[model samples]
Target: MYVLIFSDAGGAAALLVVRGCHTALTAVVSNRSNGAGGNFFCEYDATHQMSNSKGELVSIRALVEFCSTTNCNSRQSTSANVFNDCNDQTTDYLLGNEVLNCYECTAQQGKNCNEKDRKCSSKKYCTKQIVHLDGGFQLSKSCSNINVLGIDNACANYDVVTNPGGVAVHNKYSQCYCRNKQLCNSGSSLGVVFTVSMLLLVHVMSTVVA
Candidate 1:
């Protein structure tokens, strides 16, 4: 069985416990704007029947059709099970198909200088990378697909090098991936302590490898 929770702009809330494989479900909603708020209870059984709070078996399809013609505004509805409550998971499900906006810029443009907002698919994450090169550091903030980076949803440090005219040049970088909020890559630091710890870990690993 699943619980369906619904709420509207006028402070009306509803909870429905449904069972069986019925094509239509009846919901007895009260008009809160007219100061007529009262209790509304609805349940469905395995016999493909629905009953209202008055213990009257009403036609599910007819009730739904009646609601549609009315001026009631039910804003949100969520389907929840026992294992999970109605919170972030429900919001995520509602926004699953929405696009994400992220700040897009590079270090060359200056710090915290976002030229435009990058529109990314819901599956992509906003990324921030700090590269420590020979001269100085380079920062890049943009939206990235996790599959293309071959990385998980966390921060990581890595090293890369190039050989030019028999000379070797190496660069170390820290990249962080986030999707919890919009424009998250615009921050100057992920966290001072966290950044320091990651740098120290990279140093220790490099020493061990050397």
Candidate 2:
């Protein structure tokens, strides 16, 4: 004879086991019981049917007896279940893609440098460029793709010759630091005069080349 007692939301339900008729009694109790849905008959007897159940229930007796030695009816968990109640609703707009945000400004001595935030388009990179001149330097920070300055590599120096005439004009630009992170190249220490000089130099170079 076996007695099965299981707990449910309302309360506990019981089943009466008759010797040599365990299977019939278990099936009847399970079908009539008002509680969770599972094949508990396997736990009610030592000899259980090899039915295609959840594979958790081993013997009907084990379930009916609630054997202290055996660990049955263990709770399972999953990623969704664990984080189901999380309140953080933050979503990534880029969805794992790179966000190239940069600070944009030009060097200009004795002049006010207008720094602004520039949201780079997709497939673009942040750049911090510095151009050395006769007695000053020009600095520009913005977003550009690999083709803008023909920078095949990050932070590599290069030269741009705008004019090659009687008085040749040479422009040397230090490696333009490129990065994939957002807002990585926003700040620069070069004075406003430097930016102004750089712009003037660029204008003159363009005019000479023309």
Candidate 3:
């Protein structure tokens, strides 16, 4: 089974295998128990399911068995069968589609830059490529009214370079304004003058011909 394990709170990692991706999916069995709500451990057996969505963050909960390795023996399992006690109460987090970075790869795990935390605080993700700080970049200090995505509290796509030796990830952007439709229509008045000039030119040519 293809299982992915990540470090959570208390420095515990588990390999959970799932069928689908980027969606909310679950599998329940009769011989299993569930734990408290709003917390996630690790699940490695048939009774364990990991739900990861690229659009929203789903809270994981189980009455029992957060981390389990399949039992080749017929022994009944206890709550302490996994671990004597839990170390971290809340240490791990999963991003469904927030676009904040730290993806499912080594590059995301070991990012390129972290010094410009203040600037990239809400702008770019941890997985996104960093740009070297130099000219040709619109600094975060100059941004106003940034846009927000479906899950983002602020708009996505603003970036700044802290290092001079950074690589490009996606199309780098700073900030841009979006004007209202009414304000833009006011500029349509300019087109009327051009139309009137063309009609006058046509009239002058006709009179001369007559």
Tell me, by TM-score, which candidate is best: 1
Off by over 4 Å in 1: 1-98, 109-112, 115-123, 147-153, 188-210
lDDT of 2 at 157: 46
- Residue 58 error for model 1, in Å? 61
lDDT string, candidate 3, 1-210, tens digits: 111222121222432222221111111111212223223232221111122322112222221223223431121223244333222222222233332222221112234323223221111212111112223221212111111111112222333222223443222332121122111111121111100111222211111110
lDDT of 1 by residue, 1-210 (tens): 112322221223543322211112211122211111212112111111222333233322101101222333231234343212212212231123655555655553245545464433343456676667666766666654321122224555566564445556666767676655665566643341122222232321222110
Task: Return the TM-score for candidate 2, rounded to 2 decimals.
Answer: 0.33
lDDT of 2 by residue, 1-210 (tens): 223322221222432222322223222211212112232211221222111122121222112321111343232222223222211111121324655555655554454446553344432445566665554666665544321222222443445444334344556655343443556555533221111122223433222110
Model 2 vs truth, CA RMSD: 33.1
Query: In model 2, which regions exceed 4 Å deviation?
Result: 1-95, 112-119, 147-153, 158-171, 187-210
Residue 179 miss distance in model 1 (angstroms): 0.9
Relative to the true structure, how large is the alpha-carbon lDDT of every model? Answer: 0.36, 0.34, 0.21
Tell me the alpha-carbon RMSD of every candidate: 23.0, 33.1, 26.5
Q: Count clashing residue pairs per candidate.
A: 0, 21, 16
